[model samples]
Target: MEHSHGAHRADDIEDARIKDLTERFRQTLSTKRMNELVSRSVSRASSPAPRDFGTPQPPPSVSDAQLPTYSSLRNIPLVPQAPQDARSLRFKNMLHSLSNMPIRWENPGLLDEALRVVPLEQIYNEAEEESQILQAEAESLGAGKKAAWGYQDCVVRALLRWFKRSFFTWVNNPACSRCYSPTIGVGMAAPLPDEQARGANQVELYKCSVEQCGAYERYPRYNDAFVLLQTRRGRCGEWANCFSMLCRAVGSRVRWVWNAEDHVWTEVYSVHRKRWVHVDACEEAWDKPRLYTEGWGKKLSYCIAFSADGAMDVTRRYVRNVSKHAVERNRAPEAVLLHIMDEIRAMRRSNMSKQDKFRLEGEDMRENRELRSCVISSIAHEVSKLSVEDIMNGRSSRSRADPDTQKALEGRTSGNSEWIRARGEGGRGQPNPQDPRNRQR
Candidate 1:
């Protein structure tokens, strides 16, 4: 009986050893295959130039005269005062034309003209000041000055810079005709997926499609304030916000303007030109000239007819239509939201010293922080697939209590044996008692 029992135990040990060896051999083969696969992928990526998104256009040959002056503005005016009577006259004329015209995207240079009369020097100064303040604030927060401002105050300020620089440019050297076409804005909200929809009224935030692991995220919610096709994703409003936030981080005062129909766009003040100019950052074609019509001929052969004028005309056509309701609102012409944004711009004027801006930012930052926290929290909670804490802590599976939570736990406290042991002891949710990882050390 003793020999029989001993034989059975020996067989069991041999069987277990064989199974273990088989698993080890399989794992070794699998690892080798994975390495080979990775090597092939790397070779392919480095083998040839990546496929271009669109046909590459030849760089525009430039003459000495055509070369742009990269001049920097030294003196920014504190106040931009336009001739009030001239402004009134133009406003009345624009109002009359708007009343008679059909609702269209082109305004025949009405709003464009009024915006031009704005003292460019003053706008430039303010935009610059605001831009500086935002940079400083980012630094104070212990966030890199170039770090993107996801919160409301910094985001809004950043937006102001983008708008001023892009949308407010002089048509002529003397600054007679100005354009304010901001094609898009981007808003950064927490991951608000579809599960938390409130019936038919839920807003969804979408992620960027580009693969380069960027930290930027945008929410494409429609606002009735801008006059564009309200898409749930990839609209001008979201684009403008994205640009604004980025510009602010780098130091600039910008703002977004949407048509009455809620088609959002943007403008930014040029401290050098002392005026507002249009910027269309969302235009995906990076090789194209910054100004419209300059590089369009290469894109479309038929554009030769009136390519330069055609691009301008095409752009103005949209602007005119955006101001369709301006006449109905009277010469008083209160774009209430724009007016508020304008005030923020004014606060950044060159006339105001850096110290003054610091004061304004101090106040703005407090209010902005509160507003942004609320927005981010609300969006995260209301969206429903995730929890607010999960997004805040960069934890996975905030939306569902599942395998993802375990994965997140491992990631958050990797290499901490004490934490793993403690987690195992008192419900998995508890923190490890002796986790040196959690200590500031």
Candidate 2:
């Protein structure tokens, strides 16, 4: 009975305290004061937000330190491939193998030996003259202006001329050792142990045309640029390999471009231009990206340029007119190619600084923009080039004939539409009635 009375007393005290607090709260919410508070709340809510004086804004985009890179601005997926299937794995392996070709040039002794065959004096003289002329021209323009082609560029140009006109020999067929007669093509032959040891992955078989002697000649397609320096003769592969090595020896950044169409060429980085400049040593052509498609009337699929520093797709560099000149890129999926590119890029740049990596990424973005512009500019040029008469006639103007044009036309005779026209291609690769075997520089 005593416990029950104490509990009731405690409950009564709690209720009395609650009632007192409620009455105090009610008094605080009285008529005029409540109205003033509500009006202030409404005004504050209805008014514009105050400026954030405490917070700092993000810095501007970088493009030469101006516009942000696409990758930086967005989180769009690159769609990289994981390569689970057997086919994708096989393709990845082959590309990895092909990627090793440029890495071979990194051997200092190999590059030194490759340069021994070059006429350094002649090349240097010509380069100096050209460089001086370019410098003078730039000076005439105004102060702070730059030359068209840098001194290093002129050196490569001079070396290219010397390489084509005087140094390297384009071998359509190896002269038979037995009778010294230019040999006729029999077919491809398996590489001999000696040839394989010397770095030939494939060999071409040729039989002497002479009736008296049936001597079979083996022309091993040596991939080694050092061996090429000694032989001084081969198809586009040899030309590009030897020339690119020499370019490296002469102290300019160079790339060996491999095409799926059995063509190969060189691209030297022109520091003056801040880009890779196209150079086809076989045709003695420079900066003519459309020469294969436009002049030779061919289409291209993959044009991969590999260097010691990196590898790039570069298909856009060569094939500007996709509708007319691009072959189906069916070797691998686009995502797989992107993945491969990323892998190679990361491998090459694994050791670089954050700032260096950022700079290169910026450079890559700029190059991509430039390449895209090429397609646009090419389309615009084609549209503007077409005359009313051409529209009526259904024909476009043809480029004038030149020495290179003749060679490019010769390359077209291969008639392998799935592939493309290139050096050591055309009827020259086969038994022709014209006997293009005799035509060598």
Candidate 3:
């Protein structure tokens, strides 16, 4: 019985060895086939095409200048380089100061307190309904399809709607409290004791428009997001600040995006999409990066997004067509700008764990890729517009007329016409002399 068992074990071992050899042989054959296929493809590409008549003609030479250049913010590398000039150093300091805006909203206690004013039940109900509709729509399309936006995104959308329509008030100039008359700008004023106590650093002095009731009204600009909760009224600055804090209160990672052209917005990190989405609380716009450029006909120089964890130059996302929408980025040298970003990122991540740092680094790499793709897509769109005849004749395609002029003519929906025109955001119109872009900040 022992001899029989030994013979069976030997047979089983031999069978296993044979199976292993067969698998190895199969893999070797597959690799050889793949190598042969690759070699053939390479040879075909390198070799001249088969002669149709006599000899194969060499390909026509194309000048480097003829090649389309897709300009984008990706051209700026993240290599750290110190500012060499005074101007660049000043720019860096200014950006560092602005970067502190997001950190102010990081108070967990304050964020919790801010949530007390929000109608959570109503917001959640709206978000749930929207998310369900989106899910159903996705499923209706087919299997393996995903919803347009996640539940969290729906929640933000609901918040945006509520904040814009019902909660926040847009004040061009505050109306007179006693007489309810409109007020005209009378210039800057000192913050009163009560205003200073609530974090108002600057106050605007305005006189009642009515000559009879020329009472001076004080409009304190509160920098604190928590204070903004109680007031709930101002321009884009107040809107973005308060709404971004509210978004954080509801568990969304937020960024305070500052535009050099005197506009501010919010960016909410979409965990589901693994990307930061643009949200303009003033316009109630979600994920529309081009709203300022294409929608309002404004040329953007800088759009920096500052989050608690880091900062990013998101100009490429907003200015896809550099020739059309981008202004000169002369604030700092590209290298110095990169260094500033790295410094801010390092400072913010200083206290973070190794795992968290690794995760953020990965996210940064992904975002860089996304920004690069934006440039590529824009180039592709431009190339698609070029006809074969135009390319062959070495003439460029005629520029397409602005098709969205009518839409742009709607102007900035958030502010009054005078204010919009003053800011040069009045769609297709002559340049405003008082455009903030023309002035030094």
Candidate 4:
């Protein structure tokens, strides 16, 4: 029995040794195979193949021949068409004139002066606090999380809050200085020599509403952003102009957006977000492109954003649903409008360095993508809200409008009710022709 137990232990030891040897052999084989592969790869990379001149080569493969040509698949580049008709010429000329707005604010000395009014310390403090809070929120979310906005974005937000609440004032009608009575609009007035010198192109005339204490007041419409720093009050034009300049004063790239519906706003390019953010100094709104149409319940025809760098027709950003919110864009042909935009962009970037022009072109492409995405997103949202029954019945989604949009349709809040109604911004109602918003400014 002892001999048998000793034999069994010997056999177990032998078996363990054999298994260990098998594993070592397997590892050795793997290492040898890997070395061979590496050597082959190195040799192939270092040496060119020897061609057999005596032997005929096989015909080159035409695998891609069946595929569509690149040009066939891609859209043709749009060739800008020059304006041929009277209306189109007028439209082009007007756009050219309006394109000069941002260029006027490019004075370095004036921009420095513009900064003096801003409470820099307060703005910076607010921006820091907001950025820190955003960072903390992002950290709390988890690893690889990013803050909603960067420091610069926070700075702009802070500036916007300060501008609307503390700096700028909205004026519909100038009050009588004599008795401080409410005034009535009495049509346009000529800008005084000093007013013209200070860049007031047009002046509005107003009379005191009081019967006995009749007083006349002149409200000059100053186009100069520097002059606006002192006067500090006007309609949408003045608000957009001044606020845009202030944005530039803080080293932000800015655009003055002109809407054909007789309203204007500012667009600040957010480097953090890689897009232009819609800012309305009048409404103190940020990134709400749908404010005019969705909030004010007004139809928009055109929304052209002009910058010192270039210009873009950003109508699609505001009027998401062409059938609903877009009015007739009949001022110029689509091709003519494209030509006008190209002309403005060329003029703006004519003096820029090649690298700067390239950078701006890239930005334009990115913004175009963003604008396209907006339309697509709006469509998707609408489709998502559609019910099977509604689709079958071919019913509109009026009753099922987006809750957020419906809430925004609470009417224009900036101006008085009478003014709002007069401008056709009261709600989704017909515009009063007597107080046309598109009246010459």
List, residue by residue over 1-441, the lDDT tens digit for candidate 4: 999999999999999987866665555444544444444444647654343222222223322343234442121234466898999999998998999989988999989999899999999999999999999999999998989888998888999999989988888888899999999988888889999999977888889999999999898888888889999987788888899999998989999989887888999998888999998887878787877777777888999999998789999999887777889999987768988998999999999999999999999999999999989988888888878888889986545676545545656677787788777776665562335422435
Number of clashes in model 3? Answer: 0
List lDDT for all candidates, in order. Answer: 0.35, 0.74, 0.81, 0.81
Task: List the candidates ranked by TM-score, beginning with the highest.
Answer: 4, 3, 2, 1
Every model's TM-score: 0.22, 0.71, 0.79, 0.79
The candidate that wins on lDDT is 4
Model 3 global lDDT (CA atoms, 0 to 1): 0.81
Model 3, span 69-138: residue lDDT tens: 4344234223446788999989999989889888888898888898899999999999999999999999
Residue clash pairs of candidate 4: none
Query: For residues 22-71, could you state the per-residue lDDT of candidate 2 as single tens digits?
Result: 55544433432444444444464665433322222222221133322334
- Runs with alpha carbons beyond 4 Å of true place in candidate 2: 1-78, 141-145, 382-441
Of 2 and 3, the candidate ahead on TM-score is: 3
Consecutive 10-residue window with the lowest summed lDDT within model 4? 53-62
* TM-score, prediction 4: 0.79
